[model samples]
Target: MIHFTPKFYLIGRVTHTGTQRDGTPFSQVWKTIDSLGSGTYGDVVLQELQGSPGGGCLHAVKSITKKAHKNNKKILTNELKALIAVKKHPTKVVTFHGWYQDSQQTMFIAMEYVSGGSLERYMRKLKRVENILISSTSPLLVKICDFGIAKSADIDASGLKT
Candidate 1:
């Protein structure tokens, strides 16, 4: 069995420079609060900046393990490319923070921690999400995309469902 407790560990966080989500400044150290999610390669953790400017200090930190698998490398390389591509024309996304790596063979991606229930849970009673696009284009058809399982440089993913 796995045991988890609130712990603070010093790790390299690849975070965006300057103010973060809602003008929250980035802290050099972060406290691991809990596990947000996980997958075959790694997991996402909810972390709090050691000394945030003020309230709203929570941020989602994605950690991926570096293995000898060529496929993993390819996926990571593609993800990085995709991220860089978006930086030029970032849109239709949440606040994007940068990424970093620790001494351990783990790469950490820091981004805006968007808190909310699942889409299906709050879709019918939609108040926030306004509209869904309908079109013949691939972009439009790909209403849902999973960047985690992204492998191709073309931005196509495996789990394209909510």
Candidate 2:
């Protein structure tokens, strides 16, 4: 396990810049201003990382507390594993930037910031505006996230169906 010592540059301002296990530069210059959503595991926040003409690059950061670590290690592991497994398919899934832990052992996952609201909310708005009901067959691009409950298939020694 990699442990990081928190660095506080200013009051209430914590910045972390270092290299990950894979030799990737992990930097957190953005501040999490508002929460996007929350679940049983943790809360997702909207972070402004890079500056651009159109409101810069926003990212969704998930904060997983240490308390959940003890009981949900497997779940956390599965989430990271699933993200890494599907990292190549950007169009089909959320882009997994990288994961890191703070000095307090709180894990954070940074991913591509999806501007549009969730599918459920989007459908609701569309129905209200267009006065048309949307069904599952409707052509819409959706990405499946929250891999904390994801499970990998088991394989036998023969490398065939068990």
Candidate 3:
């Protein structure tokens, strides 16, 4: 596993070339930065990958992983599904790029990296009380992340697991 410290950003670019399981051409240049944060399932890292072939345009990459897929397979699947569901609403949610599993059975989810810190940390930095509430019309919008414990509301009324 690739380990990086918190808030680490590279100053230069590097090329990375590899092959998928099916033997397809996979070439990308990215600056792997420090981890964004971690959750019960795994950690999220910040990266910037080349957007086009032979182009300098770089896009933010959010790399999510799980140490043991067997123990958190269900949670991983649910998080992926939830991310895909909310991907269209980029302003209100993080965008899902793609996903793949490595030889170690570790699943990697590529997503949009939001540079802003978490809402909790931002509020604390401002020296605001924890109980303070902002109105709906406030310009600032905070998104709720970490969907590991999220459940689907489309479940059947009979309480049957889907």
TM-scores, all candidates, are: 0.56, 0.67, 0.58
RMSD of each: 10.6, 7.1, 8.3
Q: Look at candidate 1 and give me any clashing residue pairs.
A: 14-98, 14-99, 14-100, 16-98
lDDT of 2 at 92: 63
Per-candidate Cα lDDT values, in order, are 0.50, 0.61, 0.51
Ranking by TM-score: 2, 3, 1
Instruction: For model 1, state the Cα shift of residue 48 in Å.
Output: 1.1
**Candidate 1 ranges beyond 4 A from true positions:** 1-27, 52-56, 68-72, 87-91, 120-145, 155-162
Candidate 2 vs. true structure, TM-score: 0.67
Could you give candidate 3's per-residue lDDT for residues 1-162 as a string of tens digits?
122112222354444455545767566666655666665556666666566764443333433455544456666666566666665566666556666554445666666554555655546676322212222235665444445523442223343233
Model 3 poorest 10 in a row by lDDT: 1-10
Task: Rank candidates by lDDT, best first.
Answer: 2, 3, 1
lDDT of 2 by residue, 55-84 (tens): 456767777886865656766776776666
Return model 1's CA RMSD, one decimal.
Answer: 10.6
Q: Alpha-carbon error at 152 in model 3, in Å? A: 5.6
Q: At residue 104, give the lDDT of candidate 1.
A: 61
Query: Which stretches of model 3 miss by more than 4 angstroms?
Result: 1-26, 50-72, 124-139, 149-162
